[model samples]
Target: MSTHSISLLLVGIEGSEFRLAAEMARANGADVSTADTVDAALTHLRTHGADLVMIDICLDAISFLERMRSERLSAPVIACGIDAPARLAVAAIHAGARDYLPLPPEAELIAAAIQTFANRMAAPIEIEALVGHTVADVERELILQTLERCHGNRTSASTILGISVRTMRNKLRTFIEAGIPVSPAA
Candidate 1:
């Protein structure tokens, strides 16, 4: 359903089911590749850098996930299995699968999972940006409060912050240069 083309790797799924799923993914603008084993899947992943990976639970999903993690693959992985029990799904999730699907996976579910992964990937960057901004704001406020509590004494503020007096002066200078108002030593 996404306009963006996703490069997907499929592991341990075959027969008409694989073909059907592959075809559906292709129709939804995904470039999909299939592998019959974990090693083969890893090879494809290392070489092609897939956007997403779908692994069958029968293929040792946990091991595959471990390998991917060890190799530092950033692609999101979805574990799928026919008649997969709740425990198996839990295991897949615990093993680092981003999502799980019952096989043969429905095209709608696959699309939704991929979209969810995309959203998840995007969220972290935004969250990190916000966190960085918030941390900077807190740092500025803390430094100002420390300076005020020290009665504008750089040495005392530095000691309290566990920083050198020179470092404290440099930080205060930075604030002043940034147009932040600071009270004179009293």
Candidate 2:
């Protein structure tokens, strides 16, 4: 958890990974709350404050983000989904999510997110990388990094990125055609 007693809200459909997130956050020393619907989450937010909110991307995440913005909710939200597509993840980011949490949540990843949000810091984001960069640019950069991290294995990269192998191939082709060097397959 982030520090001690940091409050966290996990909102999503019933039986989703949100439950695990709540458990993990709680186990990590956070005061965790759960809401099965966006409306309920918003209602709670209307009266309570949270250090971080982990919302399911499938739960009309964009609408929820818009509502949060309209309601002036300041809690940082991390969108979570099981095998969510890269496009949807990007859309969530564009809609105001600070980050996307991969489903079957990785323990360390969730912990790091909790710590970052609770501390009111975003060190993993590297703001210097976002300076005046377009979303497509960032997307491309991420794909390349994932590819490298996977030792040029497209399948592994696609899985990590929550994108289809076909999409990965297409992006790699595009990058290559654009003269952007991709690591040779290993």
Task: Compute each candidate's TM-score over C-alphas.
Answer: 0.63, 0.62
lDDT of 2 at 135: 91
The residue ranges of model 2 lying beyond 4 angstroms of the native Cα positions read 1-3, 121-186
Off by over 4 Å in 1: 16-19, 118-124, 127-186
Report, for all candidates in order, the number of backbone clashes.
0, 0
TM-score of 1: 0.63
- What global local distance difference test value does model 1 have? 0.77
Candidate 1 lDDT by residue in tens digits, 1-186: 445667878886568364466776776667889998899999998888888888888889989988987998767788888887888888887677866788776889877766765555455453454465677687787778988997888766665565777887787799899999875775
